[model samples]
Target chain A: MSMQDTASSGVALWRLVADGIERGIADGRFAAGDKLPGEMEIAETYRVNRHTVRRALAALAERGIVRAERGSGTYVEAQKLAYPLRSRTRFSEIVGAEGREPHGRMIEASEDVATRELARELGLKTGAPLVRIEAIRLADRTPICVSTTWLSAELFPGAGTVFAATRSMTKMLEHYGIRDYRRGATRITAGIVDATDAARLDLPLGRPILVVDATDLDLEGKPLVTKHSRFAAERVEFLVEP
Target chain B: MSMQDTASSGVALWRLVADGIERGIADGRFAAGDKLPGEMEIAETYRVNRHTVRRALAALAERGIVRAERGSGTYVEAQKLAYPLRSRTRFSEIVGAEGREPHGRMIEASEDVATRELARELGLKTGAPLVRIEAIRLADRTPICVSTTWLSAELFPGAGTVFAATRSMTKMLEHYGIRDYRRGATRITAGIVDATDAARLDLPLGRPILVVDATDLDLEGKPLVTKHSRFAAERVEFLVEP
Candidate 1:
């Protein structure tokens, strides 16, 4: 129906188009991971302009019901993977249990001096050497998060090299004779993705990202490493455990 | 002096502007909660065009270092409020502890039927009567979150009316003889604000919001109410307490 036909129904025309697509997904007319019809096709089916269909699709993408790939058509989003926050959380273990292959690629590594805040957080002196590493984490070839991790360079000498070689922070720590660590504190916020992280996470610029700042403590309750992770919000949900 | 001068230094012009502003904030040249200079003023100070200044400001806003007010100038953001996701989370208490006034205004409320998912979540029969309430929560007159809450209408008759009059969900629960409740499961995601919620939250469109889906349980471990709260990400940070 045209805008005038649906205008009297008290709902906006774009909303109606969105609701129609939602119903189609609910009724199995559009299956999970299925590519949605082209915007022109949807416009024709709904008897609306392409603009209306585009708005409807944007709404769906915002709701995480579908995702638009660069230069590719939109597809219905699969079920969101649950990422749990708990003591001793392991990314590889979590994704493995979910039947997804987890991969972490080291983007870069640098050795720097800790600022006052970093020194206090890591229980080290100011100007202490620190190893910072950035990596992109993926599950089953789908980019999930971009994480930056920081550790005391003196404590874990050559950590950047180790992490780059193993692509596993846990393995890097193990080489330093630390086999276990527990979560200390986690602070979560949300923000629009910047250009660099958007490309690294394979998300559209301006998409929401869950910013997680966390610290891992050794078994003795000493800070081991601090991490800043930006997760693609549509692809995952964070479960906070009591 | 301009893009050409900054380009040779290996940093984008917009990035230099952003860093200058950030340094201003750090050195107390631009104090928190202080209104920043207008875009034109900033451009003149940085010897760049207004578009470059605008891009720099957008970057700062994305980083939560600044916030733009509609039709007003940008301001350096104050320290973010820490929202702890504990078993007993009281909004008023949290805000009061932060030395800010807390208010909840009911936008709308209605009686409805629980869908299958809602019924499953609330441990009620499908199509059971439900009461849905929408409210905008504020701290010191700044909109923090827009919450949609659902309760079993059969269990708490006239809950919406009670909440509308009291403006406190805790008081409404007290009216229903629920003296105590604890948090159950909490799920967090992030998404761009929709038109309606952006208005309700006084946020710019496309701003990131933290979507928190939480269930409150009675002392007996039965679900009492399920809440979907969208918090303005720039104004608050969620702390996961151990």
Candidate 2:
């Protein structure tokens, strides 16, 4: 349903109707835990056949988004993953704790001028030189997520070599006189998968995805690295507190 | 690009290609600041025309996912948000602190038998009665996300009416002499929207979505509820800690 293209296929009308219904939920109209209208009602509302409506409803049920009872009718699903937003936890730590083998492989690394946005996060100026590291972390051999980090390039000129040879970025930073990086701030959002991600994660083209944008600071309130991570939803989870 | 059902219109294939790239970053494959493969390389890799690849890459640049230097080629986007993790924060509390209005509207309230999955979260028998509530919380009238919650029916028989009236199941629990509920655990993941969620959130069918699964606990470790929230990619974000 996230398709920006038109519905031109010879797909069933119910499937199209179902697409409309799913979009409503994603867009926050129907909302979570909202009960859908009855069959006759939905059929009328969507201007589709009752059978088509039923098919849509059936699709909802299969995803565990809703449930139906013989006489009680149907209802929205009740479920959530309460990912704590209090403090940032490293993906390696959380994924490791979950008994999954979490590994990060350096995909690319370099030093470059910080753009205006990167400069803000690092408290530097636009075009300020910064060290950048990009890696793909995985559970076992299967690719799961990706991350790229930016730091004051002057402060970590040799960061790429360390990342390639080390087990932890934090550990390497410590060796480079960064005993600790104070917490700065974080941002989380959702987005769909682009071409590169779909291929790496083996997901279907244009699959929806979860994106987390995070930044860390040093003791002097200097930005260490701005990290953006994207995850294939079906494969990974954020273990959090509330 | 979130459309797994295939497109029927004359939409550009380049758009879909761009979506795929965005998907890669989300999965952490194309980490921030990482340089993409050469344009011609991407074209060959994706089996698409070079022009199509250029358009897709251009889109990423427009979204701030990457930078295109005429001579050097395109680069990955640096991190944007300063995300604070390693702590705990409440949704309503945090959203308010950000100067964003937090509102909750109950969408459904009912009592029913716990399914196998529900019983596992609430530590109850599979057939035990449970009260479920679905609500959509808006930040500034924008339907940012949706959540569904469940509680033991035996402990909260007034759930249906109180939730409907108050529009906040969390507050209603407070009225029942339940002072504070601790979140025992949370899980986060990402995926493309299913049919129903696509409808609820008003997204295109099969669009990308963020899914969160969580469980709450009362004092003395008494299981309280299991909740699931799904958000359209780009609608809202989850916080870990600050």
Q: What overall lDDT goes with each candidate model?
A: 0.82, 0.67
lDDT of 2 by residue, A48-87 (tens): 6787788777866765667878776777753322233444
Candidate 2 regions exceeding 4 Å error are A1-102, A179-184, A218-222, B1-103, B219-221
What range of 10 consecutive residues in model 2 chain B has the weakest lDDT sum? B80-89
Off by over 4 Å in 1: A1-49, A52-77, B1-49, B52-77
Docking class for model 1 is: acceptable
Q: Model 2: per-residue lDDT, tens digit, B134-183?
A: 87776666565678888888888878788778776567878788887777
- What are the per-residue Cα lDDT tens digits for candidate 1 across B1-242? 66354213223567657756865674367789999999999999878899989988887887688999978999997467889888899999999999999999999999889888789889999999999999999999999999999999989999989999999988999999999999998989887666578779876545578989889999999999998899998789899866
Global Cα lDDT for candidate 2: 0.67
Model 1 has an lDDT value of 0.82
After TM-score superposition, what is the CA distance of residue A200 in candidate 1 from its true location, in Å? 1.0
Root-mean-square deviation of candidate 2: 10.3
The DockQ figures for the candidates are 0.33, 0.28
